[model samples]
Target: MKDVQKVLDWVVAEVGVPGIVAEVKDGGRSWFGTAGVADLETGAPRQQGECLHTGSSGKAFTAATILALEAEGRLSLDDTVEQWLPGALNVNGYDGNTITIRHLLSNTSGLFSTGLAPEVAQRYATRAGFRRHRFDAYTLQDMLKLAVSQPPVGAPGERFTYANGGFHLAGAIIEAVTGNSYADEVETRVIQPLGLADTYVRPAADISYPDPHPKAYSKMFFKDGTDLATLTAENWESLLEDPGLAPMDVTEVNSSGAWSAGNIISTTSDMIRLVDALAAGTLLPPAQHRHMWTTVSTEGGYWMPHARYGLGLFEFDKQATGGTPLRGVAGSLWGSWFFAIGTADGRHTMAVHTNTEWKSWDVLFKLIHAAFGLTIGA
Candidate 1:
């Protein structure tokens, strides 16, 4: 426990984050810790149960809901997108008939992430654009259109390309099949069933989290498509100390564009439980559970390093975690970054959230290694 706390403190002192909170569970024991100020303006420390943006970690919940529906015979993982929502993918060389729900969930659909679209970059990636459109709402259709506007990455099931817009298709399919919004389906099927009281999908119009949360921040200078993977240690230090590039308070941005892929908000404790269930095989029937863990290789330098992506979740290579095979998801947007992982049996778990997004992956790897009783640099 003390080792995990040191990593939490290290994140703030060395990474230059505003605040960080984490929870670790082992057998029947659990621990929660926090370091640094939640609100830089008020000097408020982050509390244990405060809600933080879950980002793409929400995809695990979304995928689990879809699998639960499949378990009920309401839908099949092999169902084509065009079968449920016709004409949604007809434009810009996209053929929905060729893409399956499995392709969407596994990130092999060959669709470009809507975040890669130029309009999205202009609207949310640049500092001025973030300042102007942080609160602006967008529909799933709006996001999908932007995605297809970019060239397709490859044929369906061709390779591993992380696509946010694919989950928008998943959300639409959920609504079409279940006759309810994806949020409602996820809530009824996953959240409520798991008794995760602190988890929820933020609505398109709302831009605030529940009280006792940290104020999220971002550097916001990515309009030119500057990939975080390209950043060096020197680059991060220079960017952090640049007088002209102050961190922006991104706590209130409208996440409707991310929707099912990235919009869910949850506390560290709830996140631990969510991943615990997903990894434990108790969250889905045996057959569906097998589908959830079926994985494809992911290219390095994108998303997490040395991980194989599954249906919404990812498993880290032993090399990346000092020979401890870990399975979980890491999510990030403008302001918040989150990670949740547990043992294969779900008996041991660790979840972490930082108020800022930059350099979170490096911090996440170090923390996960330390929390699991390995050396920080192992």
Candidate 2:
């Protein structure tokens, strides 16, 4: 235990992070700890209930939303994209009928990175102007316009490309089938049911936090330099509202871009709760839960064994420091990290969140190593 504490202390000291919250539970025993500040500028310490951006981690939620809808017989996993949102594809020789919900969920859809275009960047820059007006008014149709405009990077289901637009389309499908907004559907199907009070599908431009939060930073490399660190202020407000703030040139593809991909926000504890419930089969039925753990082959042929797309969760397995098997899905963004890990028997579970964008995984793996009496990186 002292060694674990020492490792945590070293992470806080060496990473210059704002804060970190961690919890470990095994055989009815649990250890929870925190280090650093929730808000560095204000000197507020980190806590268990604080929220952080989960980035791609929200993909799990989006997946779960679809599953919940499926469970209700509102839709099916095999449903094609064109079936719900007609005329969603404008790309030459490509029809929406070729894209399926499974393709989107598995990231096998051929949609390219919405962030790759220059125009998208400009529109995101003017987010402040959009927020001044009604932000939620933006609809899924608006998102499809941008998606249809982009040509397929590959044949549908040809490979895994990690496209955010695919998830956006999935969210749009959910909205169309359920007659409710994607956010509301998520709230009804996942958040409210799970009692995840701290989780929400926040608009990109809403910057107000109920409590102290860590500042996000990004490091971009230009032709002249490397390691150029730039701070991303709660600029999400502007980015979501106005496309002008986006680094991409496409403006019309703002909020919809995140869609089911990276739009959800959650706290460390809430993330743990969600994952725990998922692993314990508290949400989906046994068969559906097993389906969620199914792994899809990637183009690179490297099995994402640690990660497999479920209805709405990505299952992962990690070898801890003590040689104990740990499993959990991790979410990350500019300066935040969220993850939960435990053994398959549900004997041990750990939840960790960090405000600083530093690489907490290294420290986490190390701590696990120490806990299991294994060598570092073993």
Candidate 3:
């Protein structure tokens, strides 16, 4: 077997990352590996079995929860937003009747994104802002209010634009329909059933992870240009340089900022199981699993080339099988990145995440290639 631990170390070293923990699983067999340091001062090595923020990678879990409700006949994808939250449509003049649950899940709702709001973006995007409000508490209503107050990226059922509020809104509907917290629903519907002991949705305003986790780090960027792909080497260097404060330890940043949208703390072992089930249509009915991949072109090549957005899932031009796309999901929020991919036949799965934020695209592709032995264009 290839020494994946050594390969992980090489990837971390090459990318200037703090640490990485990964899980590779196939059928009943699995391997855990790690590299680099979890804490810079203590030089604590990253562990293979530590919780890392899954970010939007948690979107699949959220989607799964909703789909499970659908399977139970509690709700339908065609249900309107106003059915769950009546006045929410008043946000930015959106017509709730026109926006369906599937639209929210599919990223076709074109809602204004709370994460893009200047205040929300600044809190985690800048060195000064990170120091000030890294742990400040915000509420779910706050994010929805921000979304409704701003103009949307596009009209409902229009072009695809990633929006955090869409998933947040989905969580709102889940709570209204089920009379249970989104976290609880997910836990009962998915986590408990799978016996995934290491996975959980973080409570709003709560930022702490359980034991065994790398201290998360985020680059403090004051401003970003119009295009992320066009970001120059100098820009990367500047972002990497010590700001007024060095890289921020954002492990405890307010989880409410992501809420049910992405605020899930989990391990690669748990995620591998989650992603494998998602790949194999075990999380949702076989008929519904295809719905998550009814992809529409995001036309966001500048950010991720050939990127296509589906119901809480994403497909890129470089994945295995040219476009067979039921493979996996990847996500990043502030200072954490993680992913899970399953083979076409659903026998093998690989999951990974980084404590360090950004600067690891090449390594992600390399890791996928190394683990899957498939030249997936990362």
lDDT of 3 at 266: 85
- Per-residue CA lDDT of model 1 for 1-378, tens digit only, reads 888889888889988888888889999999889998898899999888898888899899889999999999999999999999899888888898999999999999988766656677567656766788888888777866766787777899888888888888898889999999888999999999899999899888988988878899887465344554444323434333343467888887788888988789888888888888888788899999999999988873255667889899998766666776678877987878888988878999999888888575668767876788653235
Q: List residue ranges in candidate 2 displaced over 4 A.
A: 1-4, 90-93, 120-142, 146-150, 203-205, 215-257, 298-312, 317-327, 345-347, 358-361, 367-378
Which is the winner by lDDT between candidate 2 and candidate 3? 3
The Cα error of candidate 1 at residue 125, in Å, is 1.7
* lDDT of candidate 2 over 1-378, digit per residue (tens): 566667767777885554677776666676677777665556677665666776677887888888877777888878888899887764655578888888888777777655443334433233232234323334566566665555676787687656667778888888899888888988988899899988899775664444534444322112222111221222322223222222211112233346577767777667767777677767777666665666554435222333444444544433313344344566554456666665555556667766643353567666655554544334
**Superposed Cα deviation of residue 148, candidate 3 (Å):** 2.5
Residue pairs whose backbone atoms clash in candidate 3: 91-148
lDDT of each: 0.82, 0.61, 0.74
- Candidate 1 Cα lDDT to native: 0.82
Candidate 3 global Cα RMSD: 3.7
TM-score of 2: 0.75
In terms of lDDT, model 2 sits at 0.61
Ten-residue region with minimum lDDT total, candidate 3:
225-234
Which stretches in model 3 have alpha-carbon errors above 4 Å?
1-7, 223-245, 301-303, 316-320, 323-326
Give TM per candidate.
0.92, 0.75, 0.89
